[model samples]
Target: MNKNKKVIEVKNLKKYFNVGPGLTLKAVDDLNFYIYEGETLGLVGESGCGKSTTGRTMIRLYDATAGEVLFEGKDVHKMSRAEHKDFTRHAQMIFQDPYASLNPRMTVGDIIGEGIDIHRIMGGKERMERIYNLLETVGLNREHASRFPHEFSGGQRQRIGIARALAIEPKFIVCDEPISALDVSIQAQVVNLLIELQRDMKLTYLFIAHDLSMVKHISDRVAVMYLGTMVELASSTELYDKPLHPYTQALLSAIPIPDPNIERSRQRVLLEGDVPSPINPSAGCRFKGRCRYAKDVCHQQMPELREVGPDHFVACHIV
Candidate 1:
């Protein structure tokens, strides 16, 4: 956790789906980023902008149409059976929906111990002990292990999901909007638990969420995506203070400030036009339609992400 090591690296990652005989939907296109060991990299964008899809693709939930995902310097998609099993053991996911992700039929202990049994980590008393320990680790108790998922509240269900992900002792986890489905009162509790767990366990995370404020609170580095492509990436503090991309600026402007006077004085960047379709997208910049400062070049050529400031990268012709 103290060392600066990369846990995951993505290079020119593209995931496309064929909707019809001639139409193709680009869910993730040429995305390039890396997550350091013990650090949280936040991926934020509007819905359907491929935030969740990117997380799923990185974890091999969906096959890539092109490009490579390197987990600990090994290609995730190209791994053999043994390597894939090892990768699965080291990497786990906490899905967005707590209610849907957990199996209704299985007991809490069985659900949490499923990975332990699949990998044959332990059995009998030892395995039962492990399940009980996992439950306690996520703020639950052994008593809850005998119950089903329907018996728990939304926040408790998410905690159970967290326990399930940690059962195998994974190094990297894709937290795909883990707290999005929780009640507003319970959201902070879950986020705080995740933060504490990361500090205690020395875990790395790819936190994907549309909640920019929450992302800033948890992530070290933030990557902003728009229309299946990365628009900007920088340290959380730097990106929040000085965003370079139009989409990013608009997104930040939408966050409500606490002070009434300051909020009223602040200028909101209201974007014009609807988001362009990702299906068979045009040859130019995907954000050009909504960007007021877009020029002729933005319509003719797609912008590639370029380093603008120290550790700050942005993909925009004007920037």
Candidate 2:
């Protein structure tokens, strides 16, 4: 978490999908941030807000249209084939849908051992042993390795997915809404496993999720995104306790409190309209249409992310 060392640094990263010659969808636009070594940087936003796109772009699943992504101070996009394969071993992703991500035809043993085989890191007996250990680490029995995806529950399948990711001994992982498809009770278990594994392995994480409560619990810092742009970034406690941006304040106001007295006392700050379309977005702030305090300047000019406090940044005219 030290400022001096960044495992992954993203500078003005952009990802756009081409719909046609004159049309494009800006999924991630001008995002600038860095993930400190061995820390979880929680990326929270509404669906289609580009959180997933940002993660995918960083891993090169979708080639970024602009900006630079550096891993350990090396440019990720410029890596050679051999270096790319090495990069894959160090950086792995646990996708949101466990059932869809895992192969239905492959046994759990094969699923976990696939990375080892591709990397040529181990032989037959050692690879099988590692797969068994991974299954055990994720709270699944060794015998279950012979079973298919359908044999496991939603939570168990997720554990299998996690086992696969960990099989490669990755130093960093992008958890793309990993628990969004699981039951509420099961979510905690998966989250706890990630936290524990991170501690044991000293791993860094780009945890992209919509669950603010879970994000608050798991993240060392949180980045708030709106309509493909990052609006605010700050320490988890600072962001939750004293949000500076109007958009951030509005978002936090919507989270429900358990206590009846506190819940009744709180007033929800609803935005005025839906998120603006990203395809050739209007010049100005992406949130200009719904920002409560947007002024004339907000509609005509875009705001840059500027530091407001130590390790705290916000982008908005009102901020």
Candidate 3:
């Protein structure tokens, strides 16, 4: 991997929602990360931990409340109309729910060709031919192009989503839990397809998921998030083998081992207490409430992500 080539750089990116008159939800709080070109950077966290929100905010689907998202050194939220349209063509997203993402009223061909039409890439026979090729590229036939999203199965619909994202030939894609809604049997197939496509197209991806085991298989580097803060980040193998943060250790311990003997002998690290609310969160280490090794310092200051060993980073005062 080329360390100097950065496709997306997120510096203190934050997204908050005004829930009510006085209430605000801190969905993503001061997130900082980078996605290198031709690499799949996995963002793994529990539900409601701002994984999807981060992805949406990165692509400018939602306006960030604070900080900046730099797509190849350009401010994503401050782009001109033409520049924003160009960014859309370069960066695309595949949503989590295949059933809800695709338009039921539109046929498969129209859905895939939507970006092509908006970009004025082609017209007439050329557009039709492009759609047909995309259909076949995603393991679908030409005949399936005429059918609506309602007719396809969950896996087929996800394949359609993939085709649609690829239609404009995007260099970057935010895969927001793309296989979460699919059947367990078909999840591997979809993941394998993405892997093959990434290899062939030299695509850069920010793959978000809650499943740590799955992330280990597909990601070159993994970032572990809790509540709305990142706890640990490192290469997939290193993070699993030597996690520095207490939250990271607990999350890794939850993943069931394939070997029966090892699984039976291994001790599970279970976290206590409920996750604290993100709305106007108090100043302190977010994991201190559930962490077993919390100290007085942890409850007083919010630890910034610090480099401990090589590329591994941890946000824990005790560590």
Clashing residue pair totals per candidate (backbone < 3 A): 0, 0, 0
What is the number of residue pairs that collide in model 1?
0
TM-score, every prediction: 0.98, 0.98, 0.98
Write down the RMSD of candidate 3 (Cα, Å): 0.9
**Regions of candidate 3 where Cα sits further than 4 Å from its true position:** none
Q: Pick the candidate with the highest lDDT.
A: 1
Backbone-clash count (model 2):
0
By descending lDDT, how would the candidates be arranged?
1, 2, 3
Candidate 3, residue 197: Cα displacement in angstroms equals 0.6
Decide which is better by lDDT, 1 or 3: 1
Candidate 3 C-alpha lDDT tens digits along 191-260 = 9999999998988999999888889989999998888888898999899899989889988899998999
Instruction: Give candidate 2's error at residue 308 in angstroms.
Output: 0.4
Per-model lDDT: 0.95, 0.93, 0.92
- Give per-residue CA lDDT, model 1, range 155-264, as digits (tens): 99999999999999999999999999999889999999999999999999999999999999999999999999999999999999999999999999999998999998
Residue 164 in model 1: lDDT: 94
